[model samples]
Target: MEKRLLGVIDATAFHEGLQELTLHRSPAAIPFGGRYRLIDFVLSNMVNSGIQSVAIFPKYQYRSLMDHLGSGRNWDLNRKRDGLFFFPSPRLDHPVTGVGPLDHFAANIDFFKRSEQEYTLITNACTIFNTHFFPVLEWHIASGCDITAIRKGGVSLGMYLLKTSLLRELIETRHETGYLSVRDAATDPNSPLSLCSYPYEGYAAMIDSVDTYFSASMDLFEPEVWNQLFPRERPILTKVKDEPPTRYAREAYVHNTMVANGGLIEGTVENSIIARGVKIGKGAVVRNCIIMQKSKIEENCIVEGAILDKDVKVERGAHIKASGKKPYVVRKGTVQGAWMNS
Candidate 1:
């Protein structure tokens, strides 16, 4: 059954609310959980589910995403037979919409036609969850539904499972059917196709805005949430770099924070998520913050309830604070000087 499934990810989403982060890359490539990209969760889930063939359709800025996923080797998807496939959209003017836009899929229709998979699992690239699709396949098959929409608490999770033949039909007749994407066909109440809902009880979070992203990042501090998403049996995979273990100074004090590899901590940190290769200089206080890779918070700086993107620098004695729910976002590779504290 796993061999019959093909995983398709739509990585073209551009959320206006997350423009600060998406200015340089697609939302799918946004860093998350200190060490993983947003696409890692779903991509890893597909690989873990024994789906050998996976295709990603991306648009807008996707260089970072391609770099992070590189040959799909970390996930063991670099195969000569059926492995990772990348199709970039040619329609630059096409509006970015929900999962599996028929227009985008139509651009690479030949790949779909040549594939041997009987069923296709379509999903968005930015949702965070840890679950296999085998059970959903069983439910769809048993229910005799043409499409199964994976839901949690009656809300669509932007995941769909349907026959490959039906998907091709929808793509071919999208203009006539008035369905712009697979999400459209599966979600429309007046559609003629049979639809089923599969309720997933596990924890799921969709990152559509800075607030939601911050909330989800902070949630990792909870043991239950962390355990559910990072279970040993089905671990979330990411690009691995052989960086030295994080180094901590004797004066450094940390509690309730998730710090990634190759970081140097020399300050007081609490309830934050610090990504790879970050540095917190002596006497700095970072609380309730999300600091991305290689960001440096220099001496005596006080940062609270903020998100510093990769390569950001905070000059000495700078004070940055904002609401935890709505974090103050510092864009990638920017600098925060002491004067900005005014």
Candidate 2:
């Protein structure tokens, strides 16, 4: 087990262009694949690698996030001490506003000061990839680096390991100055922070926008992507839901689709991810779509190239058309069948 260590899930910035999917939930808590949340990838990695304690910093629309994460029992961090911790925004005292990296840490100063953990593993909640942090920690230890970050394509996944004492010094000593763009500052030659980068050779997807989210969602269709993400060696953990196997009627036609448990398919579905408990009524045609949990498509409806949020109900005999450039989306729990377009 990776003892004397802590995890930080930084979701202090709003992810743009997610539309209805992020209306009432943080992007991290947004559903992915057939049944997992976007945050599950990171959380699963943390637990899989034997790191127990974690503190999640939620930004906007965190209600659903709270519900999903609960007590973090799914990840098995529900211990008597040094378990899962939820830190609200520092601005929660006054009014709602944007949170910077400095403020983000300042709010949870106690976590840094009081935790027995020597090393802090900081990471963003939206980057999806399975990884073991122990090796990264070993690398940081061997290199004597002040900060070790995992990067792919010039973007730091925020998965970094640094001495807790160093992080505390940066916050308390530099209290007057703000370091929101720490990534930019890390690249400065004059900066004293000894930074190192670790190359990630795996399926890494940053779901910050609808375009990337759609692209990554579609990528799950590929055999290579699916195998690497949900490989036999490492299993992604999430909140448990005992849903029965998906039932497809005799006339139902599904091709190259991934339907999760409790789904009832009675129509034609092609090249889509149908999440848990979705109901595709008879004569409906769903193609190139991501229908999230518990959404219903009534009889004879034609849905193509769209993303439907949780509990959305598309009525009978309606036609909703979207494209890769612009996907038509129905907001969460909003009854919008033929209501509008993207």
Candidate 3:
């Protein structure tokens, strides 16, 4: 069953308003939901659908992406045959606006040609959602189209389920000036490719901008969105870490916060999402914030409507807030001192 379907993760497809999150990594590598990278959602979707053969082609700043996905063992994508493949991660320079996943497909044409899977699923790595692809694949097989793409929220998620031979043809002919964007090729009226749409009703979030990222994080405060993402039947998979339980001191006053494993909390946290291994000292106040892994909020500091990237440090008594509008993002590995305004 696994060999019949191939999964492709185009790691460089989308990045806009994500300058802060993508400074050191691609958009797919952006951390979300406290414990999972943005790509984890799509990868989990692929694996949970019973597809074993997965190939990921990441663009520049892909080391972190590689480190995170590893061999895809956590998703049970590790096998001698029809297993996970981390394609050649070449560092590339492009126009200021950058190109789409066309390059990814062009470079991996050999892989597409070699795979035995009858159908291929290609997706960008920046969408946050939980969905099973098997049903969609079945519909695609029945529809008899060359491609069946998931359409929701007035936008195609850059997710396509295609016949393997058709995809190979697209890639082989991609050198033509007009065929670079897969969307254009699929939708062209004169083209021989038969493209159709598959409706998707599941909860989905496409993170193209910083505002979307922040909003999606806060959306977790709603039980519905949280349940949609962290569904009981299929879990979002990521690389595991070995750390002790989060230790909360008696002084910790946490309310309405989703704190991951292995942290030390001794502060006032309300309406915030705290990642694993974070430290909130006594007297610190965090409100409406998303704190990433291993960040530290010292005593007396106040963070409101902000996002703390991984390994950030906020010195004592500092203040960073968005005033109920924009959310200030503390870039990865930033260290703010006593006097700070953001």
Candidate 4:
């Protein structure tokens, strides 16, 4: 079979909290687990699955994403038939707005229409996990699904596999009003037309048209429209278990070297990850904490269950306890919990 064209959508803002160290770069460019960029996981997954053609949709703060991706050479995506593409934001003359994923779908309709492939894979860049999308694609085709969305339990990872023809038709049929932010329109009831009120009703409409919708949450497409379209259990629902309990945040870093002058390293680190250029002063104990680059942990300080961002300085004799989705940083003797800059 001819390989299907795959497009990865890395729709994450670099400015999200605790993302400054990596935000100056795209989230995709943020360093993770010691060496690999977050984008590497997704791109590696795509390549390993045999999906040849890929395009990255980068929004603002994409300079780092571009610099790292660099013609997709690392992923071996620099070939003529199997090259990577960077889809820049549409120009003002083109005048596209509210350009969410679906809008990106509408905007790039031509790419799908002209491609020889029958299917497309769309995914986000926020989460860190390894997946073999070929199985999902196989499931999508074998089940005769027009659209298949991949979801994990509790959190929606924002991945989807769909038929190019069906997606194109949906975009065309919906026309200019095809896309809208659910958060924005949901907040304002007076908003003219939500994606809910559109020709397809909602995401379920598209999924129901298919044979199945797979998600870690069994009722992945359990939209209010479920009643309008089909009976309960009408659509084949499948649950995908977490491959290895996908974990994020800074706690993942521990026991790694931080390069810098006067870098004091005194800790018991085993299989832990750390960033570059961090200084652990003498008599300071760092156990299982992610220390970002250029952070200074002063002497006699005990840092346990904590994550420090770049340039954060811990005072002498200060103690830290980590408890929250956010990272902990000490700024000028004041300890506070905040999102780290990428």
Best-fitting candidate, scored by TM-score: 1
- Please provide, for model 1 over 1-342, each residue's C-alpha lDDT reduced to its tens digit, 9 standing for 90 to 100: 657999999998778988988989899999998999999999999999999899999998999999999999999899998899999989889997678889999989999999899999999999999998899998899999999999999999999999999999999998899898899899899999998899999999999999899999988988899888999999999999999989999999999999899999999999999999999999999999999999999999999889899999999999898843578899899989754321
Each candidate's clash count: 0, 0, 0, 17
Which pairs of residues have clashing backbones in candidate 2?
A: none
Query: Which is the winner by lDDT between candidate 2 and candidate 3?
Result: 3
Candidate 2, lDDT over the whole model: 0.81
Residue 29's lDDT within candidate 1 is 95
lDDT of each residue in 169-253, candidate 4, tens digit only: 5567554543432122222445342212111112321111001111111132234333322233222111111232212223223
Candidate 3 residues 74-112, lDDT tens each? 988778887789874443664212223566666667888
User: Model 2, 219: alpha-carbon shift in Å?
Assistant: 0.5
Q: Which candidate is the best by lDDT?
A: 1
Ten contiguous residues minimizing lDDT sum, candidate 4:
205-214
Candidate 3: the clashing residue pairs are none
Query: TM-score for every candidate vs. truth?
Result: 0.98, 0.93, 0.94, 0.61
Clashing pairs in 1: none
Two-way TM-score contest, 3 vs 4, winner: 3
Q: What's the CA RMSD of model 4 in angstroms? A: 12.4
Model 1 TM-score?
Answer: 0.98
